[model samples]
Target: MNKYVLSLLCVSSMSFAATPFIYHDFDEAMQIRNYPKAFALTNRILNYDGKQFFELGRSLYNQYNPSVLPSRSEPIIPKHIHQIWIGGPLPEVFKKYIDTWKQMHPDWGYTLWTDENVRELFPLHNQSYYDESEGMGVKSDLLKWEIIYRFGGVYVDVDYECLQPLDELHHLYDFYTAYQPLDAFFVQLGAALYAAHPEHLILKHCIETIQDDWHHKGAPKKSGPCHFSKSFMAVAGENGSRDIAFPSFYFYPLGSKERVLRRSQWVREGAYAIHHWAMSWMPINTRRQEFRTFENERSSKVWND
Candidate 1:
């Protein structure tokens, strides 16, 4: 009994003759544009008996998407930004990007979680996992979900440069994701920048699965994009319906060769952020040619002090 599939109108009045009367009432409600009543009638299909949603539904992994229902009334994700710096000092270029986020949204709350603070802020078990993770990327990925889930705000990678203020997005969605430029089967969600309300099911599934399903050797496959992408779509409806996503073209203009071999003029114009592709975790042999360290002069865009 997939309650979500129940027709838009199926409320019962306990009589065969009640069908026509119900339709008449429904028509009147629609004519009056009473969306609240229409929604209530639809929710009746679930016959909710006050059981916790976790116990009632088989899995929220298939709930309204991009990953969760849009926040049309009041935003669920707070107007805060969370970033991680679990290692040493940030590079000058990275710091510049962080400042841009503040310049763009000075009133929004900002949190920079460092190694010392994360241990105090996060649970002991999480500290163990963070301590054991191989690289900065892995450690950051682990905290990205937990911190955002615990605090309900936008978690952004320190390397991501903000081109625009993210305040407007808060008005429309409880969960939002950034996508890679391309995918073989489904939308490839980038972990670099995303917003969510605390205890969001998608984030919950990610946190729970990372511990059990973590067999991969790399961060992307372990807890980064590859892992998060599968969890994201599995919990979302087909093709990420009802969910909000900013495509790669709008986030990572110079995507890796695998995706947007090169960015088009239009793509650059539309981009709201830039991921400077600082692949510090890659081995010397594995690192891509273009991921220069911040020392080499940057080909800057939308950069602010």
Candidate 2:
């Protein structure tokens, strides 16, 4: 047989020998270049394992299964907020938006780390991962995980606008993030906005996974959501008691197209913040014209208002 066919056979056999439910679908999806679908299936399997363990833990600890406990009933916002800018000075619009958040939560502490600061702060062993990132955007994305892991807090993309005090939602879980579904088979937990306590294993795993597995291929999403999603699933599978998933609408109320169109009306009441989809750090080209236009419009709205 041809080399390609032989490789496929070997991959299929290896997948079959591993966890049947876990790796089979993932391998199939990978073969077809349906990375998103593969990731989604992996996440689903991991979540299932998490839920199972959670149920068992509750039964053993509480002497009753609290399987139906509401995940979002309580708010548990952490005391810290982190934002990063790798290139240079924080833009005027982002500054204004952050100022608004400060006005609403005067007691909370905020830190804006620069590229140099991030490089200085991150662990030395992981420097290669940071350096190998596709661009500043992916580098920034990778840094956020380390920041949140080292110091428990809410990490928000500068492009997002805070609508209210996040403390209420923060109190809900020890580690929390929302899913950004690209399609039925591809659901990604956004790194755009997430909250985690210090030494959270998932955050550590994400950092290490990026360091070990990042191959300098694919889009920024690969290093960001795709990597984060898979790491999260692995963590959830290992420890199942925490609430790791949040509905997408909480952070990303509007879809990618609507975000660019500036459809403010589509903002759901349940949304805690709005991701303006600022692809500002993205490479400039004709296809990204919409990103540029929306960014200009958003800047105007934030600065002029």
Predicted structure with the largest lDDT when compared to the true one = 1
- Model 1 segments more than 4 A misplaced: 1-73, 124-127, 183-187, 237-242, 258-269, 284-305
lDDT of each: 0.56, 0.55
Over 4 Å off, model 2: 1-77, 181-185, 219-222, 237-240, 259-268, 286-305
1-305 in candidate 2: lDDT tens per residue? 85533543333333221121111121222122433343446346433342333233223223211132333554444578898876656666465456545655678899888856676685634677666544566667777888888878889888766654566545546676666533334455677888888878888888777754454354343467667776766665245535445545555655554424332332223345567666665533422343454232322222211
Q: Model 2, 92: alpha-carbon shift in Å? A: 2.4
Provide the lDDT at 2 for model 2.
59
Error of 1 at 199 (Å): 0.8
- Displacement of the residue 205 alpha carbon in candidate 2, Å: 1.2
TM-score of 1: 0.64
